[model samples]
Target: MTGFEFIAKAFKASYTDIAKRLNMTPSAIADWASGRRPIPKDKLPLVSKLFRIDEEYFKKKELTEVEKIKIEINYLERLSKRDTEQIPDTYTDDEGNQHETYFWYNPHEGELRYKYEELAYEELVLRIKRILTHDFALDMEYQRTRNHFHVVKELTELLDQDDGTVGIMEFEDISKEEAQRRRNLADRVNSISRMLYFLNGGKLHAFGKIDEFDEELFKLLRKFKIIDTKLPKKLKELDDPFDHRL
Candidate 1:
């Protein structure tokens, strides 16, 4: 059963009541129930929490390691398709600088798909982080923006190397070039920053204040379903906890 159906059954509520609570129309809730429309990721947690159900239980399936890898590959395939379809033809500007600009038939749909892919990537990263922390006993610490940028940079570097094997080789022996490539790949994968900003009802600003940074990051974590990813003990001990804040 879909999450909406589960929630409706568990709460013993009418579709109208659930719709009112979710700020959606009854038809929308019924559509989700009937699989006529997919549940938007943002509302999944809210529904789960309201119903007091384990969030993971509402997930489509328990993704295995192999399945996770396959998902990443699928994301790459989608990215390739998007790039091929949306990217503009190369042209030289007045300054003699050649550049390409992507054109999209539906820019909004493109943005939505990009965010969906980013959410998948973030889920994989969290899984990897969990494995590193629990299985390998690494002294891993999650610092949201700080740690995410660091890991993205390192992974990008690994993926860029000519002879480097970022995912193929052992993490310790990954070459500098490979690390760079991996970092770049991760950055691209995480480029849903714009989508997160839009979803949070904020405009993309070149320079953001501290409050904006916090809100943006929280929105990103919520969008990617990574709010539960373990944080550093210090951050975890803060007065304003990160868990479930979104």
Candidate 2:
């Protein structure tokens, strides 16, 4: 039997009587009775004690397959939230050194600065997807003025070298295979960035119109069977102003 059914049978109380006794609205009681609402944890103990029912009666039952899947999806969303959180303005390192990080947000001027040093390629891709789905996704002012493309460009530069160097600055060395894996990831990110740039109406250099970058991205998309495989036709239709820099 459902928890609410058990509660009613044990207490010999109508839904309205239970609502009045618990200081809750009758609709809430009805919701519980219909299994439209799960019993609040704090109310569980009161339910058990007042009705002299076993606490186990109110305990959550084994989840169905669909319920299990929902729980798993919620857990994965929580994990993603941790990674996609905006970088704080300032933070202290484990070594006790304090550092000020750049995290600008000026809606009036249409600007947003995002720090991406700690983000992995997978997380970055997710962030790009979220950005694309934002209410301001098609806003030309927000798209062109925002620092999103700048941050993505920086990430591409970081993936270029074996030592994770951006410019002349070097970091710890990684294996050749690992370096190539990063390059491949960077290529994916670069492809997404280019797509965004085009969608945002950015102008492109004439000679830079159809380059290796577009060819690579086009091939990648075709392999994944996402959009149309024909690059030139798609570009011509969009009046494709490709910006290879981003």
Model 2, 1-246: lDDT tens digits are 465554464334788888788888989877766677887889877777766555665554443323322333333344454544444688899999999887643221110011122234445555655665673656576665475766567555544424323432213254475357556755665565675454343333432767767655554554465454244554546543563321
Off by over 4 Å in 2: 1-120, 124-165, 169-172, 204-209, 212-246
| Candidate 1 C-alpha lDDT tens digits along 1-246 | 554464455335788988888899999888877667767799878867665555554454234433433443444444555655555677899999999876754323433343344455555566558654554443445544455566555445433434333333333443486457557756654454443344445433322433445545655665576554333343345536556653
lDDT of each: 0.53, 0.52
Clashes (N, CA, C under 3 Å) per candidate: 22, 0
Can you tell me which runs of candidate 1 are displaced by over 4 Å?
Answer: 61-246
lDDT of 1 at 1: 56
